[model samples]
Target: MVPTMVLVADGTRDTRRKEALHDLAEAVADRREAPVQAAFGSPTELRAAVESIEGPLVVVPAFLAGSDAASTELLAGLDLDSRFDACATAPLGAVPSIVAQLVTRLHAEGWRPGDGVVLAADGGPELPGNSERRQVIDVARMLSRRVQTPVQVGYLHAWAPSVSDAVARLRRNGHDRVAVATWQLVDGADLHRLREIGATAVTAPFGPSPVVIDTLLAQHRAATARLAA
Candidate 1:
């Protein structure tokens, strides 16, 4: 029997959101050996899609991992209806494996264990006062503690000391050649901006590694397996 799999995500940006959704869907389909349907829309639209679908639903955030107000809103809306058994997986940015990939990227970029580095994210304080920007800080703190480097949280848009600002600060503090690890899933505007600032840019493991496909596939398989259990 073929299990029903519905891939849904918050579709704010017409291009990037759609690409992330389908990229995830294709990855899931390839792994589950089942048919997967993709849905791209706002939170309201996603809730409606879930209500209409007869199979298991996996809601994946296009943004990095960690919970935010918008994500909380979506989850709250879903909780209003208990007709379906659904589970929201971690955002692509929060997967534990992502940390490992990031460490590898840093090492490859010549960042030793004690090198002062900044894990810069595109998220800013601008999205909303309670956006997921804090996740960046959380990740940076965790990584910094693990690697024994001083990592400070900053944003590219909504927060203080943007990546460039952070870079300048690091340089002024005598840490030259600061490695700017991009917390983006795919290469786009933010990546371009990082390059423009002359920061030594490094993408998250998913952005340049094939393991991203494997991770998406595993997420879907886990979702389906849970439903079956």
Candidate 2:
């Protein structure tokens, strides 16, 4: 039986964010020619989809991993639901192509040397690994190394060095053009706030990008193959 794919994301009431998730699901559905559902922060929807599955079920985390408050918690609840046999894939942030996507977006937006770059993210997992949250910071470093420029970090919700502060610091550092590499899969209040803060430019979120959709599909296919095994 062909496994139905479920894309799980950090749920939000924002219409644009919801639409972004649906759009991504539709794109992957079209390419894989398979049934796919987007359960954005809805345990009821996820359970319903799982309980109704005819075959194997594959859960793909559409948001970045290490977001314990979001993806991790959601997955934990799935373990408790136990409505069906399911195979899951790491969150989209685990995809190695993500770095490439960031670099591509940076260059596409006409970023150049002497311009400041900030990896503006929602927040990091609080449970501990490194107090400073290594996931987003590591990503920032990866972006920095690839672009051959220093990359600053700004957390939208939780931690310090807010995107606003990062932008301000860049201004003080003599960077007239500051670009924020928004580390989100969908557009919502966070993106809106990042935009309002006076960054010279903000790279688009990953949602509608083909690279993201393709990576999601790859993750689903891999999980499906695992279930078959």
Candidate 3:
């Protein structure tokens, strides 16, 4: 059997918030036939969760790329040579799996062939070419070719051509209706930024699409399989 592992998150105490994490954990566990332990709450809780699972383990962050202090500490603890043979996967940025999910969400939301899709991320000089921004660009470029829509890149924080700028340009170019597919997992900072830019239609993290769940599970399974090998 695959060695025991745990999924750790800083965790929101809100029941609604835990629902998504629990669902993804269960899906990954089912696919790999490995027991999964969830550790949520304070740093102590997270540490305990990591300790519970024996042997080599992986830390899969639910967050997008950012300078999260708590997350940084957790990663530092796991990155040490001893303790665990830990590898940190990029926090669900614009990996192929996520891009596929986003594209599907666009289609489900009635985005027509000519609709403009702007891939927006938390871009700023502070986080220039950060993992999240890079992944969004990659996803948008690939999606542009696949969807035949004008996919543009914009940033909410530190990057140029902000969503407002993109929107103005798109409107000026006669693309009146634009859909902002937030390249973010959950609605918080990124969502707020989207609102600030006056995004009328914003796609949900993964849009409640079944494929998003499956893609996340596949990522978990593939990561575990690589570790086992």
Model 3 deviation from the true structure expressed as Cα RMSD, one decimal place: 4.0
Best by lDDT: 2
Each candidate's clash count = 4, 0, 4
Residue 108 C-alpha lDDT in model 2:
84
Query: Compared with the true structure, what per-residue lDDT tens digits does model 3 show for residues 1-229?
Result: 5545466555553454456556666666666555667654567777677766667666666544431324434544553355545555555555565677777777776677777778776554433234555666777787787788778877765567887888777777877678787765444444655767754467766532455446555556677777777
Candidate 1 per-residue lDDT over residues 63-152, each given as its tens digit: 454322333344434542464466655556545567667777888777765456877775522333343555667788777766788875
In model 1, which range of ten residues has the least summed lDDT? 66-75
lDDT measured at residue 213 in model 1 versus the true structure, 0 to 100: 57
TM-score of each: 0.72, 0.87, 0.73
Candidate 3 Cα misplacement greater than 4 A, ranges: 8-19, 30-32, 39-45, 63-80, 93-97, 124-130, 187-196, 207-210
- For candidate 2, report its TM-score: 0.87
Clash pairs of candidate 2?
A: none
Candidate 2: tens digits of C-alpha lDDT, residues 38-60 = 78766776777667666677888
Measured on C-alpha atoms, candidate 2 has an lDDT of 0.75
User: Which stretches of model 2 miss by more than 4 angstroms?
Assistant: 66-72, 80-84, 124-132
lDDT of 2 at 58: 85
- Candidate 3 global CA lDDT score: 0.61
